[model samples]
Target chain A: MEEESQIPKGRYAADISSINEAHARIKSLILKTPVLSSTSLNAISGRQLYFKCESFQKGGAFKFRGACNAVFSLNDEDASKGVITHSSGNHAAALALAAKLRGIPAYIVIPKNAPTCKIENVKRYGGQVIWSEANMRSREETANKVWQETGAIFIHPYNDGRILSGQGTISLELLEQAPQLDTLVVPISGGGLISGVALAAKSINPAIRILAAEPKGADDAAQFKAAGRIITLPETNTIADGLRAFLGDFTWPVVRDLVDDIITVEDSEIVKAMQLCYEILKIVVEPSGAIGLAAVLSESFQKNPAWKDCKHIGIVVSGGNVDMAVLWDSLNK
Target chain B: MEEESQIPKGRYAADISSINEAHARIKSLILKTPVLSSTSLNAISGRQLYFKCESFQKGGAFKFRGACNAVFSLNDEDASKGVITHSSGNHAAALALAAKLRGIPAYIVIPKNAPTCKIENVKRYGGQVIWSEANMRSREETANKVWQETGAIFIHPYNDGRILSGQGTISLELLEQAPQLDTLVVPISGGGLISGVALAAKSINPAIRILAAEPKGADDAAQFKAAGRIITLPETNTIADGLRAFLGDFTWPVVRDLVDDIITVEDSEIVKAMQLCYEILKIVVEPSGAIGLAAVLSESFQKNPAWKDCKHIGIVVSGGNVDMAVLWDSLNK
Candidate 1:
């Protein structure tokens, strides 16, 4: 909690120094995934594209960075008590692996509707699972109950200073890898990845344009950007399971202030982008991870007057935790 | 024919100097693909695994290296006459793209039974197609007819000196990337890739063990390794379409002296390995490309006591021109 006081207020909510510290802190724990580009993909979009493949990150996503920071930042006393989070995605696996590295317990609250494979992944990583009914309210209530009983730290998926700052470390690596990048396209779910990247990239080079790619079904972030208010979808129907969640409190501010624009893409575009990734780049990109490229190829993005000069683009492939059922459905449908 | 004088003769037929020249010639043309690794894959095999991802290579395979060398090595007179080859796979696309880079026309003789997608790829790269009946004899006849009619220089897929030297350049990149590698795994089709890699790797470090992976159905190389002579299979059947070709004369001598062993894996094993590659490594590995990793996981390889000491291993992912029909069928079957 003492670290909370050190967090900056207003425009500079996340410290660039804190991101640097997080990079050093989790240096040995995570992989610095390769920045890949393709000749065919570049030719199609008429842009020099660079893909930061975080799908190859530890725990199959960039969540490992933030999760590791949360787990390792805890003092011995807090670490002894352990940490808890309600997640059915890469975050659960990330937190589990991160806690296991520190020899601490990780409590994961997974909804009953989550796939059996995801639950098994959390268990395999040494997480204690508490099952709840399928719904946000149920998931939060169960997680709250666990916290009340054990006094474990609640590691939010996106809405935490430590978590957001840790995820921001990606930009530090990306900027160094491709210093000439003019625009960066990121897929936004609960907005942790984009928030972290935007803050770090802007601090490094304020001229760099930060854009968010969102699924049309879950275009809360896009709607928020245009209307200057949050818009929660009653239901999300996109094939990108990882992008279903809306923006969180801690992430929304960074995204709103630092991010240049939000571009929405349909599920068809995501599948097409994924097909290109496999066909051209020889990489398996889950739907959410593929959205960055989807946005780049979209009519809205390509025709945007503001983005015409964005010849050098960086795309963030956020995760590779593929929901196979969704993939089959998307492909067939 | 004057260029043929530069090719060394005797037991050590392919000169190291020739490979060095090829490396210098194609340095700017080809990509130095990264050697990737996985923690979970390493844990499963109990060895540090490094993957040379030629799947990400231009034209989606390592064949581009050889083709680029052959196309670029031609003198102005030869270049003006253009080039021709008989291939219905990655080689045609590779050769077509390579010739296009040098402003020379590439003629491809494809069997009538070849897939429409493959023909489209050749055309996409500006290859002029001459159809032949579905057999090796017809393919050769068509290519010879085209060559005689047009005086186009013939580029043998695996047998040529320049191509082998160009393919060997991968070894220079891999060895420089991971100097401590104790074993190198390569998937064998016509043996061009393995022969080049073995020669280059051994030249860099004599102690490095070079092993070949082959499909059981198309196991000419593996059979040759065991029998001390080439045993061309009368009929080949395998899901690894790129690995169906028999060994060529120029590559066999290099393979016989340099390669340590050949490991054969089943189509089932190749598919499972591909699934693991996509699930764990987040990379799309075609059936042919995944065979190297599959060999390491094979029962015989695991039981062999001689291989116990081999800790750090490098696996060449040969190509990523995946057959989607094959992939879908494999998954469903």
Candidate 2:
């Protein structure tokens, strides 16, 4: 990885400076979510852990940080024309609220099969939802058409610098809350959150171990890191819908250079971890948010002897806007 | 009411000073749980609300506050001999953990039909569980026999002054977190939590309106408040097992004198409220805890013109140690 970094071909990856700018821009718009210690998870994982509870954030997900930053960073003229994006749920709701706050129209292209609760949330936030077929091509085409027709600014969910910076705010809060933290475990989807967190953590304390967790079904980041290149999946399958994307060009280098390791967890393990979070922590965590804890509890990283020396760990609980029916089925299983 | 207070016999009632003393004594042992603001509930109820999340306390309920105070207040010889109590679930777990912390044996007499999860928690905390028939007489007889044989200190779950004072710690924390709160709502079960909260809130700010929430199916507290005397229920038939007891003599006066009003919510309303808590707040609030929100959301209290002036309202989320299966069922319904 260091050898690859020596090459001058890759774009200058995200750094603490970019994250700091993003934090300053989005601070007033987004909540400073708390870092809560989980005694039960600590006892089970044998690692003193702090959970960055982004589930308590507005729109019940950390996506709001990125959405707000992306929308707010837009030029006055561009923002007046409004913004358009494609998402299953969280990003749409986040963008809607962020745009609404700026008195700008938000056009969200969502898959026809998106959960009702999320769709309702987007509409409640005054976003215009344009339904697309349950496929990425349809979603992209719909969003592009909306952008072209309405002349609205296109906000890529994870590929944009502002999004990564906004996501990095989680690390800023975590490091401030627990300065002694030696390791950070963040769930990776398109590498946006982890990329930002890695940059922030490494910048503050270069010795900090930045780990990435991903569902096995959506393990594109792990494969990408292993191949030393960006990898896209032909198809995605996971209960953690928020973590189903492949890494973008912008996100790849930041994750590649900053993150120490990427670990994958089975969907069953993710569900079981979610159950434990609901039972013991009394907090509802979507499947993606539970993956980091799942990896630690399953001892996936224990093979690395350096992990044994880790004194303090922080895990980002990415989101909690889950459908109750789906949660009920998962709990029963 | 003021004239009644002037009577010599009624003047000796427990007040805020006693509640404050109890709070001071237990402040070190109990958790100062967070006060979570709800956007969804606020919009629905049209009231600025803060949830005093006692559900996050150690032992997963407010019962721990009372249990810890009761157990620790015991004399050294009595503490060494251990403590025994009879409860359906929350009280048993609370007493077990509190006693375990003191390195003393805890004998808990639970009904045969107690949830397996609660029983497991009791054993996990090193408490000895003695099964009794699922009735008041059988539980009392079983606890008495164990106490007589072992010379264990008997810690009454709700009827004791020490227990009531211990529960008052929640009010102290709540007011400290949100001192500007104009109204405080709490669920009533044998009037322990509400009694403590009422006394503490009255002591802190006499103008703060203290409201009691009770399930319609088990409205013993409501009846007691209306009749100006304790009213025993013919049968308890609510999912809120934590709020199914009759008001005790010590608690009755507090409810009548300190509590401004008593409101009732239906079982279905409680289930709906729990679903909302899980879906919106992402917190696992037990049915008992949900009842206070249920009263506010269902307009049971809102219809009262006096409540319209309440600028800041505080609700005590008393417990969260609910069975996953039960939560699943409630969410599905």
Candidate 3:
């Protein structure tokens, strides 16, 4: 049961207690997002689905919970120097806003080729933009240079104990909100979210089932789980811009050992799920956010005998930072 | 203080007690929709706004409240025959669902020109659809014919006392959810929603202010308020299809004596609010539902001396039954 030995020394520190501590630490700093359901959706899926609407969380995503916890966990000396991160996604904006609340500067290393809206989001939150080339190597180099120059703490988006523990708080809230939940469907990217979720949920209710949803175009997590090792892809293709990252050392072991299964879905299925969220649930969800719903409604999940008795399902709706113009254009095509 | 006498005898009968009874009668049948708020929206509007999200109600609108109340209030003899209504909007679908739940028939007289989606909604709810000309006269005649054929009781969308009383339940829930609310901004259509809101809110707290929002394209409510009488427009226009109807005898007295003011907004403003709801609030609201937010953010309300101190406000988001294909087409154009 003790998986701590599997992780490298002085790394992968989060556990159920740490997650509970994270909840206590950041309780006042984040919004307790609502759990929503639709009767019509229930009929279609042949199960009662409770949607944990993290889309309504501050910064328009659940990223704020982790970022806020990570920023606040710093020592006085580290806090005085502010924080730094490399992300062209929700984490960049979340970290910026979190730092702003704590009255500290945030250095955000975003690729130059990143969308204008994302760049604007970081700037709107008072984050100092540090442009890098359009690749992970350039982004890390730029962030490292900023950390060297400013002595600012480097906050990993999801591959850190502090970050994942904060993300784990969602599981505690989810279980409390719907105690009858027998299964949790979460979208897998870098595995920070599901790592935290699996730890917290399994610790709380040992009988609970954890399923990971992955984009078929970027099924690195599914491959890693099957191969019993991490598999980093040189190229990834998917409309889910948020779910392209490979699992880190901190997240891989938890995902590999704890996840019940990984379900990969096509881009078209994600689009259909997004439309359903918009039309039936009356809630907007980015492609990545819609993955959990897509997984729940997928043919594999519906027909699989293992998941036949999983009647009460909880879906983590992770984010809603979509570009409407781009989404509608793609949808029209 | 009694306004019941203003209505013709044997016509309007709902009061605060009747509204309370309606709440008890239909409480088990409908969802208690959430009251949502946004910090950025509050900062932009310079007031704390609580959105009473009736869009999450049954049948995707607050019409279910009134329809359910009316359907359930019938005696065994009257209820066995079923119910009838003439609507091509949220009310039609709401009535159909309400009747279906009671194990009775629902005869929905819809205009021939009604959108395919709306027609589909009624049919999906097991309503028997009767087609008539697009005009109200023909629709009414068709509904009358259906009523005579089946001996079914007629359920008006909003004009009836029972319907308004059922709608008043929103005020009770909203006030309890946000006790600090000093003003209620409601979208005015046939005046049922606002009239019920005003009566209940004022009864609960005499100092509470009630403001009605009307689309300038179909600004009959504003005109009637200014002229001190009902002013029916021969040809009404507005993208907010739900707000085109005039106030009825049962609702006029409530609006005339209880409502503080009626604010008319441009279709452009309503569209902007709809976009804001989609982008910022992550909620889909029809044009009529968005009008309350539009009115609150309007320059007239922002600059008005009378409402300057009205800080804690509640906006009724009336519905979310939108045709996204049509909406996207118009937006693209």
Candidate 4:
């Protein structure tokens, strides 16, 4: 993995600057969530782990940051045309809220199988919903049909430069909140959050090791890293529905180069970590949000030499939107 | 309910100064927990609500603050003698942790029927535990026997002057965190936390309204207010186990004088509030921690003329240590 070659001879020199601008842009519209630590967690891990709590952000996730930035970055003419997206999770609600913040309309295409609460979350933020069959083809077709009819810009969940740049701001704030961290452990989905954070951290401090945690069930990112090429899973499966998506074109190069390690954990491990987070941190973190901590406690990771030297670790708790059924199961178990 | 009469004019002249000193004394040992807000909660209550999250406090409760202050305020001779308390809840764990920080022994007397997790919490902090029958007479006799044998100073869970003064530090931090709060809602156990907070808030602004929230089943504090004198309950009952204790001698004066209202909520309402706090706020608040919010939503409180004028409210989330069986029941039901 060539670090500098990933950028194709440095055409993205302004990525950090864009992230700084995103921080300023969304400062008023979104929450700058707090960084939290637990002595109990630290003792168990035998490392100083700081949790950057994006769970407290509006819409209960860090996606709101990028969604706001993307909506606000549009020019007057494009802004008036509004935006559209196909999602049934945090992104839909995020884009809906972002559109509302910008005083623009948002068209959301949701799968019929999406939870009622999630759909209501989008509607609560004033998103116009269009339902489709539970498949990628139908979702995209419905979204594209809406986009063509309304002439609205389609906001990709994670692939866009602006969205990743907005997500990069999390690392910037984290570094300022707790300086001199030797490592960062981030959960990888389409690599939006981790890619943005890795680029920002590497630009500022080349020695800061950026590690990616992924579910073994839906581990395309880890497979791609090992094979040195992108590979899409035929069928994805994980309790962490948010981490099922594969890496996108825009996020691949940055993650392949800047990410120091890509480790995978079993679904059972992820659920266990989720329970630990709920019990010790007393916060309702979805399975996806607990993956980073799961990787920290994984047998493979603990046996690695890097674990010995990495003293101060920053773990990004990406989101906190858990379905009540799943949460009840986890708690009642 | 004369404010100045409670203090006896000549005694306790610099109450706020003592709180400030407590803040200084235990600054490093305790967390200055975050103040959180939820748009959904505000919309439901029709008021600007800020939650002072002491559930995020060390030992899973705000009791740690007072416990630390009591342990550290000791002279060397007194410190060497150690400290003791009879509690099977957050206060016992808080005292144990506080004593551990000051490098002193802590003797804890617990009922034989106490939950295993709570007993573990005390032991985890290096406290020596003695088990007794589940009754006030047995609990007190066992505690006194331990005190007589070890010469350990007895720290009342909420009644002692130093402990209440230490609890007062919460209001100091809360006011700074959220200034101009028209109403302060606090849960009453033995009235240690509320009395301290009320006194501190009143001293700063005489017009600030201090309100008490109590469980209907364990409404001794409310009964005391109605009768214009203290009256002990024959038997206490509530889902909010942390709020089951009767009001103490020192707390009665401060609460009776400074507190404006004492509202009670049914256990069902407390559980409903607990679930809401857990789901919407994404925080695991025990029933006791959620009582204040329950009071604000109560029919009696909602119909009050004073409620119409109060625009900004601060609710103190007192603790987060709930029995898993109880929590599971709360969630499952």
Query: How do all models score by TM-score?
Result: 0.94, 0.94, 0.94, 0.93
* CAPRI-style grade of the A/B interface in model 2: acceptable
Question: Per-residue alpha-carbon lDDT of model 3 for B1-333, expressed as tens digits?
Answer: 534433323434467778899999999999999999998899989999999999889888899999999999999899999999999788999999999999999999999877665677788889999999999999999999988899999998888988999999999899999999999999998988887788788878888899999999888778888999987577788888888888888898889888899999998888888877877788878889999999999999999999999999999999987777743333233
Q: What is the C-alpha local distance difference test score of each model?
A: 0.85, 0.83, 0.88, 0.85
lDDT of 1 by residue, A1-333 (tens): 332343344445466777888899998999998899987789999899999999999888899999998899899999998999999788998999999999989999999877555576688789999998989999999999999999998899888878877899999999999999999999999988888888778777778999999999998998888877676558887878789899877777777777899999988888888878877888887788899999999999999899999999999998886645433333233
Q: RMSD (Cα, Å) of candidate 4? A: 3.4
Task: Sort by DockQ, best first.
Answer: 2, 1, 3, 4
- In model 1, what are the clashing residue pairs, if there are any? none
Runs in model 2 with CA error above 4 Å?
Answer: A1-13, A326-333, B1-15, B326-333
Please tell me the TM-score of chain B in candidate 1 relative to the true structure's chain B: 0.93
Error of 3 at B128 (Å): 2.0
Between prediction 1 and prediction 2, which has the larger TM-score? Answer: 2
TM-score of chain A of each: 0.93, 0.93, 0.94, 0.94
Q: Pick the candidate with the highest lDDT.
A: 3
DockQ top scorer: 2
Pairs of residues at least 3 apart in sequence or in different chains that clash in candidate 3: none
- Could you report the DockQ of all the candidates, in the order they appear? 0.44, 0.47, 0.43, 0.37
Write down the lDDT that model 4 would get. 0.85
